[model samples]
Target chain A: MSSPDDKRRTIRDVAKAAGVSISTASNALNGIGRTNAETREKVKRVADELGFRPNALARGLLTKRSHAIGMLTNDTYGRLTLPMAAGVSEILVDHGVSLFLCATNNDPRLAKLHLDALLDRQVDGIIFTATRIDLEPPPELLKLGIPVIYAFAQGPADSVSFHPDDAQGARIAVQHLHTLGRSRILHITGEQNYLAARIRADAYRELAGPSGQVMFGEWSEEWGHSAIDTVYSQSGPKPDAIFCGSDEIARGVIDALRDRGVSIPDDVAVVGFDNWEVVSKQTRPPLTTIDMELKELGHRAGLAILGLSRREKLEPGIVRLPCSLVARGSA
Target chain B: MSSPDDKRRTIRDVAKAAGVSISTASNALNGIGRTNAETREKVKRVADELGFRPNALARGLLTKRSHAIGMLTNDTYGRLTLPMAAGVSEILVDHGVSLFLCATNNDPRLAKLHLDALLDRQVDGIIFTATRIDLEPPPELLKLGIPVIYAFAQGPADSVSFHPDDAQGARIAVQHLHTLGRSRILHITGEQNYLAARIRADAYRELAGPSGQVMFGEWSEEWGHSAIDTVYSQSGPKPDAIFCGSDEIARGVIDALRDRGVSIPDDVAVVGFDNWEVVSKQTRPPLTTIDMELKELGHRAGLAILGLSRREKLEPGIVRLPCSLVARGSA
Candidate 1:
């Protein structure tokens, strides 16, 4: 626990301790300029002894690499981007990199403004993220000379993209329910417009076969509660398990079922997608949901961009990360 | 809409249009070196006509002012900080100032690392934010020379601090419930250890008087659900209105009431604090809650730091911004 009064070891401190010029110390540390090997080794040793850390700014000026990344996002609510941002920051900070986060609010003009600003600041590279997946990068971002990595979203066909595997997440949820001896399962999810909803539904159908029921509605708790009526009204046997597209919908379903005198995981088991902690963890029986590994996606995105910045070879195209089931009390 | 192909006007463009050397144009625009008044005026006109935006990086080299600020927070989830971040960005972007965001994740070592990094980057100022209120800045941030502003949290006694008025928010929630002609009101909130919970509870007592029942518990939906049992078990008349500390608790309360066949508004109206959109707006009846105006606090913090950077006079104390009621179906 170093006190605030404990001044950080600066290049000046290292120079003073090594009895050398600041530039000599800096050149010695960075392996540039005309410094002798013996002097460089001595400077390095002194720097290490004093815990002297070179300022990235001074290093960046010589290398033309700011070691800072611009993270452009349009996720205003930060529902998806926050975790991704956290994950990206988690890895980048260790490399003496900082993040410049910009929210474009999905406006092309705003996006361009942010892009230009970040470029003017001379960020090492850019990582563009979104709340949902897209097939291509924005038209303006296509020609950027700097490296770009898309996380929780897609970029151009040839660009590196990272996103959650919704199909696998759906499979995990359904398989978990099946292992619990629940055969009559119903899939109630968000609107059909979302690619995630469709992918999850497709996976559910393939795994559950003809007996599975799939209903698409808005991603709202109200819809989740109302869908219960439609499920019970069908002529066939009532579903013994329900898989919701989102935690919000799952919460609604759980509450509505409980209100009807049905015991969770006793009369029926329910599972959800996007194991959102605030909602999933607070549910009556808590929620057994799919963890999208968004943070991990972010972590990979950070590493991929760093690699690209160093001109390291990387595979392009969409890279779907795995999703797994988070077992809680509900299932 | 302007196409992405339309490149932003540069100083070179202005110089060419004004028929002056690049050095002369730079001197005139920045008001540096030897430049005649007529030439400076001519350059200014040409620059204005061309919509020339000065390169901050270039200007930074001479003035040592990057016009950049670092926003450091420990709120990894970004639940409270996102809106504040958005608000800060909203104000600072217009001034051509960019933000460097770092999440410390409540690690003192990480906090020190981030602070040192930001300082090394030569940021003009720093804004320290947190998930909860603190009486002072972290021990590591005490001695930084650059301007520092606190948002959604407090810093040193002499620094400008901006935070939500929890007491005012509680007053507004209580007053709204009272105006609805609901006398038997109960305050069900989170743990008493939280400063927010205590302030809000104090305000509730003053506004609702001695009769106002206050129950302190965990900040969870489960607590909200279980509190209903405690309230109903009492011999006296049931509460006609419930004011919750957070929207999560309100959602639980609303759901529990609905399950018990108690009609919302007609039987018991509910109000909540922190008008969290995802939780409040998605509630069954939609929660009427106290809007803490956290974004506004962030905006103010940004402005205060900008002002301080310019050596402008500002009062040093905890500035509590007023909270307002957001009327919805719940109350």
Candidate 2:
């Protein structure tokens, strides 16, 4: 019996067993150029009998395509990146592509080093993801010939990018609340710095009209709690519904409302954004929120890059994917 | 002016400029075999100026070392695996090692395919992580010569494995509660099927003698809320301190207690496990809980694999990393 430590069978072993030259055996096994059908079959049979496995690196060197993707990101928490990566992987795997993950931590030098290293490895393409929106990918990455797709963030003006339709997501939430007869809707949101926060706030203003109460603060539960106090302290009537920037803020609003003897949905229907499962599902009465469909965005990005790799021309512009409302107990 | 599509400088370009043979230029650039010092310096200077990047796959084939690792995980949510991966990447990057990430999703065939692909790519070693602990790696992996380290899971009897010391973590939680002068400490945890749940329950019984209360159900927040009702319905004395199996459970307990007008850290103190930042920090009063030290476990696991890759002998057994206590407002 062969021991487990025995060296793996090599192509040379197949060649010797088949009584053929190394070049003939290699050509027959790889189906490179034309060869006799009988000889090719015999070489393949010999290789299978010996359990010979071809070296991917050698094949990649010869073909100039590694069939691997370099997935670069600064999102260490994997909040959006994880699902996005899963979608990308789902598409890429079916195409026989593997992903090499690297975190740049927003460090320019580290990003350059990683980019160079990945380029040296001859990856077929690259997918760049970020925690926040950016105007463009680093200039160094644009020069590389490999296909590049930016997901959950913007890239250069000439590059293709994917992101959620934040304005549309806000509209869906407001429409849902409106359908439930919640007119006096207060908009409580995070800081004005984030593009997402501003976009959603603008959407709320357009959809909920000029009289809608809009407050911007930190993206925290504490902010959500305090915003309620600020609203109630005002001279006008209290809100019958609240559209929060995030599930965290919504949780705080619900808790504060509950503490003040206000019943969820009956007294003040609440809606949140991001539909984060942990926070949205665990809240008392649960939470109805906007789902960004990040995975779908990533899946489209994967397909786009695969197309680019095949020399197919692609439109260079932002593709804003549609968002959906996940209705739960609260709203 | 250069367009974005410009090709990167190649070794042949460097050699042509340096007035030397390609073989000599390559030997000088890579510091391989014997080469004259003057020619080496000239080639290095020319190569740097041209930005000649070497092909890593070619170098790997020559050296028989890829300087890359395959990280195979089935943890799709990235709750534990992400932190572990970050730790692994930290060490690997410092040593000029790249990571190849693959999610097998508990499919034996998929796992085998990934393993073969990684091997074909000439990865130096492999790290296997899982959604839960298991007795051994897949039988297909056992035959490979590459070093394999199991993290947050178990491997074969003679292989190295790393996991959190669940029993010790429970001891820490119980001891902390005891230090707070809590006599009637109630333990509310998740399902009885989980190894972690069972280990913590056993530890609670040992440390609390015969008087401690232990309840097991779902790992959901709803379960925590209902368990409180069950406890108070037939109880002699209500628990002064509650130790929850997870932050979600603790959050429910805190919310329910607050609704009943129970002052946190005054009428009752609460502690939790997992120290999940989002849940723990967002509680009415932040939770004081046990942290599994997962990142550190991952860092150590990375180092262990690095050593193993270098053929250094390692102690073959489960290395139970100690968990730590993170104190906040609740306790």
Candidate 3:
């Protein structure tokens, strides 16, 4: 193992070893300027032998490209940010770009501090992300000269952003139940104040027409269990299918139905949103849920940001990525 | 809003505005060399007035301190790594240092690629983390000239590493059960091959003496549910308390016990490991579990890395952080 005192090989050493001027050595290695082809090859070979890796800091200074990007997020638990970050890293790493993740934890002061640090570091671009799409990023983000992209968060009207199509996802769930030959469908969702819940409820209402029943409650398994009692206690007719806003809620619904001695998909079929593996896969019969595809949204945003970093002209608008249904045992 | 075409204020500009030599201005702002206190204050005032932020890349070229660190992890799911990374960021950000996260996805080749990128960027240090402590990081990690600290992962014998004390955590759970006057205790855990499972089982055996029973199975809710049947179907004294290896297992055990008309803390008490809020809180009566304090381990690792970066003397060895029991209605 090399000691901390071991000095890294520098371009100067490579130049001396290759018997060329410093400028010629640099141009040859970079494959630019008016360096002769033969000299370039010789210098490159010498550099390879000497194990000369160009310092990113030095190279960034000359080219004005840091080859680094900053990701500012308010998702403290990483429920949404981590997968998105993984997708971003998947693309950025191949392009020799490193990502810096700054968790603001919803503190505007902390967010501003992190932003300043990123700007001072001369990051090529910045991607703002959050747990939900309704929240807007700091206004100062738009004023920054460098490129900016919003992922899983709302941005200004003239900015580029990506989020899942919640309404479309709701439609897919309702359609799946419809195809399964179920007419009475009930929507059990999270708090009405949440934009996602409102959007999903609206879509379900549109499809269910006048017969659709919507219940707004907490996004918890407890809520799902109680919702069953509230719906079944009524004398009219027990819904043949139930669409839950989240996997947690669906798990509860499935458990409640089982406790009541009702057979799943026969007495009542259950559909869920957010294909969270832990919750969706562990349910008694597993849950058929909607996947927001946050990772894919992040991948597209990464590519767009990379293009913008290279000064490519990109249209400014909101791009709603499609969500997919993960069919399991329940529905 | 500043346009991309607008030029950034440089040190030279600040120096000219302050009516001082560039070298003097640089020295004064940096608080070094023979610059007088009066000149230092004047230069700083002038720089601030010009909205001048020092370019970190240029500063790093001279000081060899990039004010950045890289974190390499194989935790693709981010279940464990995310909380640890958050703790790391919490400490490092306060010290004006930025963190770069490189996910290797357990691929050796990918790990090498990320390592090389971090080195090229001149990151002051690196932190290696993973989902488990038994797994060793790439051997190349030790050979890097920069300081490296292992968090939630094993390091070489003479290197620094941090992990939760599993045996201690198990003992705490068993002791809590004993305090509740539950003499007949059973330990139901995941696969025995896992170091954590074995250590925890060993601790339980030590505490329960001759009559302690342990069942090794998959780390899933299914195992917990079936293990109950396996235990009850036999003509033997049923355990009064169950210590689970994970929250999922505990949830399943609780559910099965409830289905069999068992009253929690009245007929049987359940304690779980890994204070995973989702599973622990959602359980019928909530769960009392052991918290590994993974985030605190990350926080301490971050502090240690910073100390190493500043050339502070730190002892190298394995540090086992204590796990605390989270009390709830279950036990």
Among the numbered candidates, top DockQ falls to 3
What's the CA error at residue B153 for candidate 2, in Å? Answer: 1.0
| Chain A TM-score values, per prediction | 0.90, 0.90, 0.95
**Residue A53 of candidate 1: its Cα lDDT?**
65
**Residue B271 in candidate 3 has what lDDT?**
99
lDDT of 3 at A281: 90
Error of 2 at B216 (Å): 1.8
| Model 3 pairs in collision | none
| Colliding pairs, model 2 | none
For residues B1-331, write the lDDT of model 2, one tens digit per residue: 3464357677888999999999999999889989999999999999988878888888887778888898888766677777778778777777778888887767777777788788888888899888666435678767677889999887888889899999999999999989999878889999888888888999988998878878999888888888877776674778889989998899888888887788898888899998788888999899999998888887888888888888899999989999999999999
Better structure of 2 and 3 per lDDT: 3
Q: Which ten contiguous residues of candidate 2 chain A have the minimum total lDDT? A: A1-10
Residues B104-127, model 1: lDDT tens digits: 888888888888888877788899
List, for all models, the DockQ compared with the true complex: 0.45, 0.61, 0.77
Candidate 1 docking class:
acceptable
Q: Estimate, for each residue in A89-194, the C-alpha lDDT of model 2 and write its tens digit.
A: 7787777777888877677877887788788888888999987675456778777778899988878878888889999999999999999998999899998888
Give me the candidate number with maximum lDDT.
3
- The ten-residue window of minimal lDDT in model 1 chain A covers A1-10
